[model samples]
Target chain A: MDVWNILEYCAWALAVLFGGHMLIDLARVDSTYDNDLLTSSREGEIELTQELHKL
Target chain B: MTLSSAEPTVQAQASTQGGERLQLLRVLGPGHVWALGVGIVLVGEYMGWNFAVGKGGMIAGLVACWLAGLLYTCVAMIDSEVTSTVAAAGGQYAQAKHIVGPLMAFNVGLFLVMAYTMLEAANAITIGFLLDTVAGLQGHSGLHQPPFIVLTVVFLAWLNYRGVLATLTFNLVITAIAFLAIILLFVSVQLGASHVPLDFSAISTDPLPYGWLGILAALHFGLWYYLGIEGTCQAAEEVRSPARSLPYGTMAGIMTLLIAATLTWYVCSGLIPWEYLGQAGTPLFDAARVTGSTPLMVLLFIGTIFSTLASANGCINDASRAWFSMGRDRYLPSWFGAVHPKYRTPYRSIVFLVPIALIFALGAPLDQVVTFSILSGLLGYTFMTFNMVMFRRKWPLGTIKRGYVHPFHPFPAILLLLICAATYFAVFLGYGSQLIAMMCFYILASLWFHFWRYRFVRRGDQFTMPWPRPQGC
Candidate 1:
């Protein structure tokens, strides 16, 4: 319950959390490989960026 | 000059999206966008005055939040129109480049990256700060250490590289957690408190607190919390009906933020005394503890973690895309344009942002980084307001279909322009040191890119409409 012990525990816990999330992201990269969003929200920005490239 | 009457050419251009695939799900609507805004506002409003100001502070803060939200609404409405027209991934930088020119656009991109970088750094430090409080780790500034902070930065960077859907899904889940935290805190306070002192009239105030100056200063701090409204524009192409969706989503987000923020502020403030909440290092955590519910405290801690992670992810996703968009135009190094061979996302740009963010998170003071974030966000908004005015005069109404025409014609637009001008000047007076230095640094960097790297290229007429025109001058 002391401050020092508490700090040590959190530092370790966050490090683990950060590491786990990175691995999960890397694993999921393969599925999102297409040149679009995983889920669409709006088409304007995506479409415009595409149009600019064509120009 | 008007565009060529050839509609076919424009269609052809729309089909090819900068040599990238058009793969995504059109799942989000105005409702979803509103939820995201609610999520951001709820979290943002919780901070700032909660710990520092207290009950009287909360009463004053809610009024302050609403006034600031109104200013944000004006800025976002203009942004929604621009975003609807473009259907592009990057937000401010893309808008600036199309309207202002490459040189100015480059400045927007540089400042945007720095601004979001500050956001990322703030989230990390805030998370660290939160953890220290919950775990009773008072002196732990582990985030200040470069190696530890770099790990956090790299983690989010990789997540961004994974692409947009993963980020959005994460956003949804984290939002749930954030809301749950609020619910738990509210319940704990009511059930556990033998004496409940409730103030129903807390949110509504006459003439508003601090008057115009109070509102202005609140807007300044308000800018800090509601800063990322435009980030949604980065995902415009992914949304189904951006013309309808952009404005609707933005409005929804703002309303949700308002409601969530009001509830969180009032309930949490009632649970604990203002003096304690204001000065307490981890005010939310302290509030949970005071409710005498260990389970609720644990849930809040987990929820805060989720909130921080989601925020960092959202910030990085938008910031890196700005870099990628600029690179695609060959404004910055082409390396930024490199898409992951597999992920098909702006992997390189996303990766590059991590180190820069880490440098700031690990190296700078927390308050200094936060001030830089506000400066960058305001500077970008100032450019956006100007762009809205110029877009109206330069382009014919018939040419661009999706943009929101300023109601009451140019008068309202001009009023907004003046407001932006005054606010930008006031920001200089308020956070003058951090604001000036960060703006100067980016301005110089932009000039270096323009004169040195892109000197030989003939500058295109930036104000020209995207549609083609006749050659006879």
Candidate 2:
């Protein structure tokens, strides 16, 4: 195979490599963690705790 | 190559399970924010703005550049005030969610994702085309471009997956080089160091082939000059201090784009005639070639490639943040919200968007991809005009703290609206069907949002910021 063809194969291989790594990591995280925990965030958490700091 | 994950710069000790966290790393400063904003936009100065020159001749192109500059200056002003107060990663989406309502925010978030992703698609396609051009010059015209397109998305997504600091720092370096390249070309042309002297009379010759209509037509393409400066706000949540960083970075970025755009137009128009400049794929590089100077040509070539890469890198960063923010609020599936335990990024969102970008990059025509991106951004800017008016009405200055306040309040908003209306007409003149198609696409997405996705959104919880009872409410 020529260099251009080899380069295309390398790109495909890297896409699979990085893309596969991400999928595996995503599955690992999804399977290992609870659904609620993975989905949970404090985006709108009201600052009830910070009230004491207000002078 | 093994990637090392980032350590938390600011610890969130809220979760006992050591897992659930809402925030990405707040490691970026104004410099990185500047990089992210400028990086996404500098690519246009290299290639796309010439279309404006083509549309209306040289003088018309200049007028459109200044008018769009005014439009974006208004955009930066409105975004600064709203984003400083909101202090969220999704930028305009978070502002709409809080000020307007859930439905508007959902659409805005979708706009952000689509705009940045399509721009990413455009950039990746450019890289492939750029490589193909290089291959052609080297007597090997048979280079397969799909691999390079695939390679661009994969590599940049991988970088974004690692951390925000490194990704943006990399953006900062390359963006600065690209910006410098424009300055170098300007200096070289002016000093008569280029192969040919600049022709001042090009501006006077055939200045407006289509009369006043050409200026209106140029407005649509003129957006390429400073299209993505408002994207600075997307880095808000990741900044060390959102209020300070967002406004400062955003303003600095707009100024940089302004000077860069003007210089680019001046240099390229002097070197190449408008008819040729308007349609040339790589106008700056072509300008370099006109001088017949190999070093300058090489410099412009490197600049184009760097600018394209920086844009794609910035797009991956912004698009993932928008998707992650939407997911975190359950505006979409919350599964996409998960930050990596080791790297402290929205890894799922970053990884997820790679294939979506790849689909468009591999499939669509470049102009189609770019048109969609520009229209999406235009829609977002139109939303900001209302967003600014409502923010002032609801909070009325003293009710809540803002890092920066735009002056001459209603003037910028009114001007912005007028400019937006004019540009809409401009787009309609050329791409009436595409404009209609885009509107229909948004309408369908909105319907889906109302019928299906609205149930998942935490409508009440989105109003988490501390504020007095909104004035009218």
Q: Which digits, one per residue and each the tens of the lDDT, describe model 2 over residues B1-473?
A: 00111345324333425554545666888999899999999999987888988988899899999999999999998888888778777888889988988889999998899999999999998888888888788777778899788888998998898888899999999999999999998888878877677775866767689899999999998999888888888886677767788889989999999999999988888889778898999999999999888889999999999999999999999999899988888888888888775567888899889989999999999889888999999999899999889989988887676778899999999999999999999888888899999999999999998999888876577886776778887
Q: RMSD in angstroms, all models?
A: 7.4, 3.3
- Which segments of model 2 are wrong by more than 4 Å? A44-55, B1-22
lDDT of 1 by residue, B1-473 (tens): 01211232242244344442333334455545554444444455445435224322545555545655666777767777777666565667767877776777888887777777788887777765665454444453432333345555667676666655566666767866777787667766666552445444433533233344544454455454476766777655445566677777777776656565556666766666644554555556666666666677677777677766776777787787787766666677654554444344666677667767877787788768777877777777778767877766555466556545545555545555666665565566557776667767876887787779676433653323355331221
Q: What's the distance in Å from true for residue B149, model 2?
A: 0.3
DockQ of 2: 0.41
What TM-score, computed on C-alpha atoms, does each candidate reach?
0.77, 0.95
Give model 2's docking category.
acceptable
What 10-residue stretch in candidate 1 chain B is worst by lDDT? B1-10
lDDT of every predicted structure (CA atoms) = 0.60, 0.85
